[model samples]
Target: MARITIIETGHVPRKYRERHGSFPDMFARMVRAADPQSTFDIVSIPDGDALPDPRQVQAILITGAAAGVYDGLDWIAPLEEFVRTAHANRTPMVGVCFGHQLIAQALGGTVRKSDKGWGIGRHVYQVTPNNGVVAGEQLAVACSHQDQVIEAPGDARTILSSDFTPHAGLLYANGTTLSVQPHPEFDADFAHVCCELREGSAPDAVVATAKASLAEPLDSAKLGAAITRFLTRR
Candidate 1:
């Protein structure tokens, strides 16, 4: 069995929690779908759970957050340090959305609220050739973020790309770290709700487009399986 520790940096709103579940719950479900024997441990930072030593965990997964990587929250610095420590220890790590940006920023990349506006709903990314982490040539996944990793870390390679999010997925030189700007754990219903939540914050047209995109199929299962494989690979 593969033991994965999930660092929960954010929460699903109270209104949606009952139906959509928390970020860790979503991830656990996704991972279990791919590897039924996989087990999980959730460490919620917002709940004041202290970060764990990276070396002690078999693998680490950082979940998406509503907070930006550069938000300067008290927990941000420590979380970044944790990511750095985990990377240095060569712990197999996977990050999604905010987690992706956080990992990049901690490793000397640039993250900022993009002028390109919010990338909500479903977006397709082209997988770079021979990127061993994710199979196939393209991936369509749910996304909800304004912040982006504009500049990737020096030791990172762009494995997934789209016109909107050029640095959609990054694979670190260390070979044990991987991150993606989209949410593979998000099901279509949850993704639609995420779009609804952006009704006022995002442009009406963008929100509508995002909501419409959800009517189509998403490649979430494919990516989820890939993540599970990455985390459990020997």
Candidate 2:
């Protein structure tokens, strides 16, 4: 069985957690659904949890955070360092949302809060040519992010993109790293709750649109399988 270490960067709000479990919990469920033989070890860095040895970990998966990559928090820098170390070790690493941005920034890419405002809803991404990271040519996913990787790392190539987030997914040239701006672990119900949670913080219209878009078809499970493949495959 492959062992996967999930670096928990942050948590869901108390209210949201009560209804939909924590972020790590969500990821655990999704990964299990994709690959039942896989085992997971979650390390919560925000709670001051120490990172486990990368040598013992078969793969490293980074979870999304409520904080932005440019927030300059003490833990942020260390997390980036850890990301670099994992890359150097050639440990298969998968990043989601903030994780995606952090991986890019750590590997000489650029990430910044977009003037494009928040991308919150079921967004569609057109898979870049000949990049087999994603299963489909076009995929719709759950997204909630204001920050984006404006410039990809020197060795990373774009794998998935959309009009709102042109650099939605990235794959390092070494083929050991993958990252995406959307949350494949987020099911439709969770996405709906997130949309509702943003009622006051986001524009009313945006919130409503997000909530409505959840009714549309989502390819989260397919993406989950692809993620499982990336981590488990040699």
Candidate 3:
């Protein structure tokens, strides 16, 4: 079985963690979908220095974080360096929300807090026609983020989008790397909890109504197959 080293850079802060749970639930599901047999050692480097080297790993999955990529954090520069080197060396890399932003920032692109409302719940992401990453497939994915990639990291191509999120997903021209802004790992219950903690209401009538239209459960199997396709190459 192949091993995946997941570097989790996102958390809701300790004061908030008791209410939110200690993990990003959605990424776990996607990893499950990727390969149930695949085991993972999660390295949560909130401080960033504790971050591990990906060179020894089979794959690197950067989990979503609540932090903005542009914040003057101590670890941003080093992590950005790690990503560029990983890509350059042909190590397969996958970025989620904050992870997506970091990758973009490192590769001559940018990330900014969207003036738009924080997208929560399952959002439908439209796959561009014949995108090799999406393979011409669309997914009703889950998301909870306020910042996004405004442009592709240098030498990257857009593969999926929605009217709300332009950089919903991207693939490096190297074809070995890809990322999804909307989470494939979110189950309804966990996603609802995230909404509850972040927005103070998940089952709220208005919120539920919004999520009703957006939150379609994507099969874990489908996402796993897609991840497998992504990692098998670079």
Ranking of candidates on lDDT, top first: 1, 2, 3
Backbone clash total, candidate 1:
0
Model 2 lowest lDDT segment of ten: 128-137
RMSD of 2: 1.2
Whole-model lDDT, candidate 3?
Answer: 0.72
Candidate 2, residue 113: CA error in Å?
A: 0.8
* lDDT (0 to 1) per candidate: 0.95, 0.89, 0.72
Clashes of each: 0, 0, 4
Candidate number with the higher lDDT (1 or 3): 1
Question: What does candidate 3's lDDT look like per residue over 1-234, in tens digits?
Answer: 756777888775577456545554445556656667766778878744376665767788887776788988878788898888888877888887788788888888878987775777777777787776555457776677778888777788888888889988888898767877876655566566556665553336546654664455554346546765676443
- Per-residue lDDT of model 2, residues 122-221, tens digit only: 9999988678777568999999988999999999999899989999999998889999999999999888877876778788999889888988999998
By TM-score, the best candidate is 1
Q: How far out, in Å, is residue 222 in model 3?
A: 2.3
All candidates: TM-score:
0.99, 0.96, 0.85
Better of 2 and 3 by TM-score: 2
